[model samples]
Target: MATSNGGLRNMTEGSPARHIVLFALPLLAGSFLQQLYNMVDSWVVGQYVGDAALAAVGIGFPVIFMFTSLFMGLANGGTVVIAQFYGAGELDRVRDAVDTIYTAFTFSAVPVTLLAVGLVKPILFLLRVDDAAYDDAWLYLTVVCAGLIGTIGYNLNAGILGGLGNSSTTLRFLAVAALLNIALDLILVLVCGWGVFGVAIATVVSQAFSWLYGLWYINRRYPQIAIRPFCRRFDRSLFGQIMGIGLPAGIQMSLVALGAMVVMSKINTFGKEFTAGYNVGYRLDQLAFLPVQSLSNAVTAFVGQNIGARRLDRARQGIRVTVVSSVVWSLLMAALLIPFGPNLVGLFSDTPAVIDAGAVYLRCIMPFYAIFAVMFSLNNAMRGAGESMFPMLDAIFSLILLRVPAVYFLANRFGSDYMYYGIGIGWMLGFTLSALYYLSGRWKRHGSLADRDRRA
Candidate 1:
């Protein structure tokens, strides 16, 4: 009953660990390459442009993320819906869901771009982005927003392929984009003297290329779900279904990004050195946890497919395997990052203060990565099972209600060194909630697309 053709790999019939691991490897590689290009941007700006530019890029991240989180969440929901339909052998529904996702993102991208571009200055002012970095931040964010269509398109394409259990193809797409981005960064920033604007242009151009390439590849290789940009097929019922699941997840993502902005505002008070250092440390942290994130994504798709196949036991088994693997990976990363954290931070800047500040952040948060992994794994499993609302509530409670306030209180009371402790505290709270909910097995009742079909 397992099908493997035209880049699709059925997960419902394999050894859960094998399926999860094989699927996750490519995702892990793709994430690494994606992060690599991002780090390259930071490196170019920090080394060639200056710490102010570095800080500017950092300032723009959470703001852009906040604006785009809704679409990302909706794309995630589309992935789940498509995965479930694919697992249940409903090819027609899968195609319909894919088309609907494409249609929705295409229509909405322009409006979101305009809104985000208009708000960039106000949001930067609110975040208290330092005067030195404000102009670069505004320009960089504006250009990126102007090309939001490319970013959204790339992500939706990845989401659709992921839903079909074809993470490998996306890996290839990312590789092309990553190389192009790195080349463009060097050429635009160093050769052309474009500075921060060049960096932003590089990102936009590379992502646009990747999106177009993915569209062409998908149409050529997987005609079953060919995307028709001009036809504009919009499925009202499917769009509603995607919204039902994605809206809460989108709200959660937005709140989380907002919380990050709040935390960034606090960090910005310390000066650009600290902001740049935090940005470098955060980039390193993202790299360290890439495997865990990939495994969590694998679990989501795995659980979605198995649940759709009505194989609850397989879904449970896959979750256990992924959690264990993520914990072990986190432990390894912590051991490595804790000792050499400063040295790695030095790669971006030669400043002793920046390196020291970055080291402090890593030391504070690295040890608690296992807790973060557990929280994400369990919560994502619930999302995979169509139980997205509770995960949204959990993120709101732990990340927004608890973490944001804790960061502010800790920074004000103990100092900046202790600010990252708030992140660990949030992780603990999230893990506790996720564990309790996962154990109750109520997620199984959340109902997959297949279950709805059976009932009808």
Candidate 2:
């Protein structure tokens, strides 16, 4: 809480090894809760709606990710920009950056939310959901997309805190959101018999609380960063700069989402039993992925803040420390998940066939957890240092250009289970390329956003 000669600041300007972890700890907890926020819905639906409905919800997952990806890119770009402003000792600009992020969230969420609402039926049709899944998938996606307003606020505020190096604040919101979601999930599905609609309703309501809490915290604690809605007009040059950074990130995420949608389509071909299996596997894996991914996020914030201060060497060292730590963490997770896959996946299904299917998906995919740790840690570090292009391109190449096509070609030989291999191989290629880009020291040669701060 106190600042000494060296302390944990919202904007860390120096790379102190211990300090970075300290800053990251709260975020790790929060990210876990955010993952829970998602999982609670599936858990509730699984317990109540049966496997077919659960598979329907699972089929909607990539579309949800795709819709949210734009908001995430905006948040990511704004966070890095604001972190650099803080490092440059540009308080006014830092405040303006936050305002820009808030505005961006509003405008961006409007069209996306409407599009999601409008296309709900057609999109479900496109995903190839069968007769059994039609009603449930339609209900779930409509409700979730309706809550984009809430999701927007949470994403924007979290990005602000992350940029400022207080991932704790962001996590705090997630905790509240997750708790709210859990309560509603039980009430709606178990008590009210709402089933699939219950899960979506619970998530949206929980997101509302998360968003409100974020808005309150930022306005109360960091008044300097709060924007007066509609009063501030957009600046074209700044807007362009924000998009220039975020667009590639968005495209990258879209490519990944597109690839996932394709994979899900393949699973759909195997019928609801296999699709249910993939859904359960995908949701449960989020539990393991969050730890490493959250740490990667911390790495980005730490690296971004320090890089802005011209502490390039320290930034690189932070990546080294984070990558090594994530590997150990991920391996432990895989060990636990692989052995207990049946128990974990079974929670989502009562039918023995669905349970067995889900367990197989988890066991096969859990082995590749370490590669994800490596991928996220290294990729986020690159993005934080403003070297996002390579990671973005690599995702496109691996996820779409390679994995999706492979899933279709190998679907027959490898059987329905081939979907797992397609995703794993894609990750391996992405991780290798990302690590290579970082080690090549190409990030250093590209000239950084940090350089602009020095001149200013």
Candidate 3:
């Protein structure tokens, strides 16, 4: 059983359903709050700075998510390995996995950081960012990218903590950082009149602080999970194991983000008002999925630890709870978004055309949120069991393989409304395919938590 600070119940030591919920609550809350924290940047900027500024932030997100996605993919894979190793009582292997994730991702992070900062202008131009908003987008992306490593570090460390069932600590740390972000956003962006640059700097500053805090927590309370400096002391076999898992996971996110970038390019062709409206709709959708996102992450660790412990039934139970709970929240949110669509979109833009376009997009896509919930949870569950290829496949089929083509052809045929519908349909396709794959009883027999322990 995994133990942190010398003695702690492994996260899945009880009834699977109850334990899953207990473990997930803190993470769920943190996820919601963190999403809220993100919303603060847009809300503050949109309300105070103006539509162009808000649009710039929106344009910057895909680029930022693309950079973070690389590290995040590695971290997702690392977290799965850490959980399995921790649950299996392989402390040394757990340490090794954590170290590999820290080292490899950090090395990759530095170059990506430089690239994001240096190439922000050309990158945005390639995405068709217009002259009016290019300056703000470049400014936002540059400052955020400057501290990208700090963001990556904090996420990587937090992944380690989550694997160890110490997610409550991550929740608190993120809460503190999010609060600081809110305060700084108000002071710098709203009160001080620094604009988008201020919001960007504040985000990076808080991320740096969180990175330090996470590192401090690991060193003080969980030294075993501490990542050693890279040297020949690093084990090649274990490094390979972590990378084997993480690379596909990272590719999964990259594909999804890449697809979004493609769609954003299409949205760009519609002119600034439409692109701006799409941004509003997308941000609101992100906000709405906060609970499911947090729960999906929790599901990964929960399923991983349980599977590591040889509790197959329990893993399935946790996944069931994930599906049902996520669907419930999704239904509630979709209802809210569909009805109050204008109010939500108008939060960003006062113009009627932009508001109408955003409202239509939200109404078009809201119902599929439940299917998205399923896809998110099941993909995480699969990854937790050390099967990452499905997620990559899921992202590929939905986004690149199918989604891109669907949007392109459908947009040409039935207008962009069909393009919006295409995203939802493709998501459903992936979700349905993944569900059938899981039910086929393959991932279950592939391995178990007990099997991992025996290997150790």
Candidate 4:
């Protein structure tokens, strides 16, 4: 049987479903809290600042995501590396992976921050942001990018702990940060009247707090794999391994973000009302998809550990469990969201047009969420087994080759509503590709850590 030692749980010896569920619950809660604070930022800005401000904040997301996706992808690769090492009882390698990740992020974040902040206005202009929202969007993006280190630090910290099979701690960190974020949002936006800029400041401050607190906690509790932020411990070989898996994933994410920006530009032409509606609807959609995303993360860690332990059967079982649970959860959320989405969107804006557009966005896309869940689950399982290249290509094929073009063609030909239809079409294509790949069993032969050890 798997045993718990300190904060880590051994996943190699347990009922796969039970282990996965236990791990994913905290992840689910943590994701929800993270999204909650983001929603709160939009709410505070929308309710108090105005619709243009709401649209501005909304427009900034994809640009920020584009800047951060590479680092986040690398962090995910580090998680896979750490999980496999921890699973194999190689504490030293786990520490090395953690250190290497921190080192990489520390060096990379500075340039990325500088570049993002410098190009914020250009990017917004390229996206053709509405004139009314342009200034606020620039302000929000600049402030957030200036503090990019905090977001990278906090997410990487969560990734490291999650790889060690300890997700609960991350949840606590998020809960505290989420509360702090809400408080700051209310004070800065409502009382201080800082508007969209205030919301951005609150986000940066809360993220920094979480990152600092996580650093302290990790050093105090998990001395076995403690992170030394300033120590500059980079392993050339390990860095190669991490990037070998991570770079393609990063490219995939960047392309996906680019695709989103393209679509957003198209949507922007419809005016700020539609853009604001799309933003709120997308936030709610993210909330709805949290359970599936959490489950996908769980499958990645679960599969990584088992693959490291050379328990392919257990990994396969866990993947099956995750896929089913994700699909079912997606369906449940769709059912609930479809009926009440208009009212939910209304909470953020009083404009009837905004409410209707947001509701339509939800209705058009929610029912097909199961398709997305299945694709994500399968792709994450491949990532855990160190087969990132194929998934990256698959994402490129779906998001870039299919989704972006479809949205442009549809929106131009049919209307804005067809833009959502294009999204659904991309999800279906992604699922088809992912399912075929999973069935081929090619991912099983990928060069996982355990496979490397066996060959050596």
Which number leads on lDDT?
Answer: 1
Ranked candidates (lDDT, high to low): 1, 4, 3, 2
**What shift in Å separates residue 328 of candidate 3 from its native position after superposition?**
2.0
Q: Estimate, for each residue in 1-456, the C-alpha lDDT of model 1 and write its tens digit.
A: 344777697999969999888888999999999999999999999999999999999888888788888988888998888889988889989988887887788788889989988998889888998889989999999999888787788888888888888899999889989999999999999999999999999989998999999999989998888988756888887888788778888899999999999999999999999999999999999999999999999888898898888888999999999899999999999999999999999999999889988999999998889988999999888888889888998999999899999988999999999999999988889989999998988888876686685565
User: Residue 86 of model 1: what lDDT?
Assistant: 86
TM value for model 2: 0.93
TM-score per candidate, chains pooled? 0.98, 0.93, 0.93, 0.98
How many angstroms is residue 44 displaced in model 2 relative to the true structure, after the best TM-score fit?
1.6
Relative to the true structure, candidate 3 has a C-alpha RMSD (angstroms) of 2.4
lDDT, model 1: 0.90
If both were scored by lDDT, which would come out higher, candidate 1 or candidate 4?
A: 1
Q: Candidate 2: list runs displaced more than 4 Å.
A: 1-15, 446-456
Q: Is candidate 2 or candidate 4 better by TM-score?
A: 4
Pick the winner on TM-score between candidates 2 and 3: 2
